[model samples]
Target: MPKDVYVDQDECTSCGQCADNLPEVFAMDDDDLAYVVDGGNTAAGEDAIQEEIDQCPGECIHWKE
Candidate 1:
């Protein structure tokens, strides 16, 4: 099954890594925090997104349960 992606706003540092690395699945809001695009779910890019999750400095990215 596909998983939903999200960024913990409180832990977010408004970094652009998510948007810069995965524009197809993530974007920055007006506040500059990364947010998942397109309903926050994707069947593809699991490995790519996981890379983001691993490399995120703030470690705010997550897969929704």
Candidate 2:
């Protein structure tokens, strides 16, 4: 099974880096905060998602435990 990914919206900087890095798992809401895309393929795999988390300037992306 793939790990789930989530964004701490409060900590989001509206930078759109997560979405740009992995649109399959991340998106920007109207508020421009990064969110885990609904019904999207989080199955892009852990390393891919983690890359976004690591690259996120806001440091808001995380694996959902």
Candidate 3:
């Protein structure tokens, strides 16, 4: 099954790692916080997204259960 990605803005550091590593799925909003894009929730970019989640300094990215 596919997973849904979410970002906790309160814990986000605005580091841009997620956006940089997976632009198709993540992007930096005007507030500098990382957010999941329209097509972000899926298995298509799961590996790359997981990489970002693993390396996220803020540890704000997560797979929605």
Candidate 4:
């Protein structure tokens, strides 16, 4: 439903951009890495999540549709 959400840990700088943009979908862990919240809740905020992915400074976010 939401395609495939992917985060490239190698390029991620833990900037929190994704989480900031889409708190409903993304969150920062103790490691400061951004991750999508699970439990089959990913597709609910598709547009906002996609916007966050596009805004990621490190180019680490992707949606494979």
Judged by lDDT, which candidate is best? Answer: 3
Number of the top TM-score candidate: 3
lDDT of 2 by residue, 1-65 (tens): 66777899999999888788778888899998888877554448778887887888888887778
Give the TM-score (vs. native) of candidate 3: 0.90
Instruction: List per-prediction Cα lDDT, in the order shown.
Output: 0.83, 0.81, 0.87, 0.74
Model 3 is weakest, by summed lDDT over 10 consecutive residues, at 39-48
lDDT of 2 at 11: 94
Worst 10 residues of 1 by lDDT: 37-46
- For model 4, residues 43-64, the per-residue Cα lDDT tens digits are 4466776777778999888776
* Rank list by lDDT: 3, 1, 2, 4
RMSD of 4: 2.1
Clash pairs of candidate 3?
Answer: none
Please give, for residues 1-65, the per-residue lDDT of candidate 3 as tens digits. Answer: 66898999999998898888788888999999999988777635678878888999999999888
Off by over 4 Å in 1: none
